[model samples]
Target: MDERLTIASAKANLEKGSLSAEALVGSCLETIKQGDKDVHAFLELSQTAIEEARAIDARRNAGEQLGPLAGIPVAMKDNMLVQGWESTAGALILEGHKGSYNATVTQRLKDAGAILIGRTNMDDAAMGSSTETSHWGPTKNPWDMTKVPGGSSGGSAAAVAAGFVPVSLGSDTGGSIRQPASLCGVVGLKPTYGRVSRYGLIALASSLDQIGPFAHTVEDAALMLQVIEGKDPRDATSVDLTQTTIPELIEKDVRGLKLGLPKEYFLEGMDPAVKKTVLEAVDRLVAAGAQIEEISLPHAEYALAAYYIIQPAEASSNLGRFDGLRYGYHSSGQNLKETYERTRGEGFGREVKRRIMLGSYTLSAGYYDAYYRKALKVRSLIKKDFDDALKIVDAIVTPTSPSVAWGLGEKFNDPLTMYLSDIYTITANLATIPAMSIPCGFVNDLPVGLQIMGKAFDEYTLFRIGATYQSLTDWYLRSPDTFST
Candidate 1:
């Protein structure tokens, strides 16, 4: 069996009678058995994965029409609320915490007959970029074990890249999905905010957080997005979206498309090799008939500063629910205040606490306008910039990061450096525009992600452009370096 089979290919194989869902699920399990230890991608393995595949086979034998994603084994990030499974969000505070119900996305996937493979590890409370902050353990890069798998969605990306699973759910609040996807050599989508339901995702930063898919191909990401998207009464912020259909983008042509390069993204401080690979990707996309245009997103320069302020402010408020009264870990204390502090301080990872403190400080009476409120105004300007650009271009493309995957323990101490990792990505969340990351090329044998940003609710353009790029190259098919080892 080809270990790197994509979701569409797997479905086709299942339909052609050349492969069985059971066989496919077993292959994924075998990959886990072979590689999960060295990679540390999964927190648990579902005994039900094989059984779920068997059920799909049973349905097929019964002549029932299965959904597009039927029989696929998908890994869920630990942060999503899956019934009968814990949604830890990689924090000891909520460790072993199972939701009373399945999150809307989980229920939707279950409806489409996707098997729940297991929960993958992430940074505690989704606060850090590297998976080293995971309460359980660090998720090493599949490309090079010594280097980091860019995270808080590190495990999700690693699993897909290593072929443990073809698709997984990852929540991106400031590039958790795309950054890790770039590091692990897979495709990650951060659909426009509210494109997918946040009803069951453990909130990191409510406004910034979005749960999307990680896959080996752009088509697969679109497929997963199609499955999980739509409005729900459960999440008031959920957008009223039309049902989407993932088309034949892989073999389709996208001639005369406009690809915008934000001047802010191409400026200095970028690694020469990453810049080179991304520029080459631009050439390839252009060769396929895309018109490259240089655009200015002046407010883009302030995205990081604005994001840090807004996200943590929302996070501090969202995290307020964790104050020893409800949910997971509660500490022994003589008074409520002690319980609150001790439970939070002890339960949360260091990075989470730091953010909380920063958030609290920013939102305090005297500092609110200077930090939180001011950041909101700048965020609006950034969103306006994207809107203006989208009017002139079909899609905007940029380097997913300033450089390729950094070595493990390299940015752990320097919080500012780690924060800047999402420079290219944070603006999309702020703008509430759909953006996606695909493996554009490699830098030093470590993959680099090429980002495509689209207009609000315009997921089609992003997919069309990304799918166009994928058709031009086979970077998406490259297996992780650890796969060989």
Candidate 2:
């Protein structure tokens, strides 16, 4: 064993009686203890992994019905509430906060017999592109310690990359999950909006917020998705979808698959290296029997502006609960007005405060139509682009991010630049489509992700295509020996 096996390989070993879930969990714990100092991926680790392993073993011994992920240990982003564990959302205000109740996804994972590995770091309240905004500190990329892992779910992706955990859950609001997974060289999926319950996730942009999975292989991500996705009464936005079985999806070949290339995504000033990776991926798909064609999404140019407006507006309302009256920390104040001001001002980081102010202003009486309403209209158009394109193409392909993972502090100060990091991803969230980031190539020794956008509720197609590519290429199997201790 190479010490890092894909879900398929691990499960095979367990089924064949060559290894046990307990042994795998123990190895993972050892890896975390030895490597987390450099990766900075995990905020906490489950010391009781052995106990969970024992349960897994007992179930197997009993020949009882086993969930697909019976013993897989998975990391979870800190924003989602997991009972008895601290759910920080990587913000200073919620530093000591504990999850009073299990989020729907957490409950589902437990029900599926998956072990909760630990919580991972993220941008403060899931605000920035780089994990540097985290109160705990930035999650360094497992490929390069001096560079970022990519944010708000950067820690979760890095945890999987560093072998701290086999798979992890991340929330996306304007590319939080996909971008980080791209930069960290892991398989990350941002499912169509409403595919997964957002009940316990700390909201950043409610309309755009989505929970997703990150793993080293496409099948592992699919496995994780199976356990967490579905409709839930707790989240009114959650929608029921017909999921394609992973085993069947994985076996499906790419022959005759039509892949659409969005012209707007290949704009001027795009990094040469990033463009190269995307083009090479296109060629790879072509070789795999996919018919590639360039398609124009007319209103695609305005996706970022539209996304920024809608996201912040949703963010403002969603963050209103943190007024310090009910839960979490509160600062000193003599009156209610001062209390709200003090709590928010002191709680949110600079990037988060900026968005909140922008959101509040946009939704205010006079500016509502000019900003918020206009953005909503453009959002409709952008969504139509995907809907129309999917009519002809099975899936769309693009660069997951504008560039490879930059230095930790590179774009931290410039919010617009940081927001642009999600250029290729936000539109997927806006359109409520399934999108994924898989390792395509490297830019200057750093990984780049080839993003595949699927039709609404068609995550299976994305997985099928991604698995085909991963099967043909050695990218996913490559490790960062320089960073993963």
How does each model score on lDDT?
A: 0.89, 0.87
lDDT measured at residue 318 in model 2 versus the true structure, 0 to 100: 81
The numbered model that scores best in lDDT is 1
Residue 299, candidate 1: alpha-carbon lDDT: 92
How well is each residue in 257-296 modelled by candidate 2, as lDDT tens digits? 9999988889865798899988998898899899988898
Q: Give the local distance difference test score of model 2.
A: 0.87
**Model 2, residue 261: C-alpha shift (Å):** 1.1
Clashing pairs in 1: none
Q: In candidate 1, what are the lDDT values of residues 280-377, reduced to their tens digit?
A: 99898888888989999999889999999999999999998897667899897889899998999899988999999999999999999999999999
Task: Name model 1 segments beyond 4 Å from true.
Answer: 1-3, 249-251
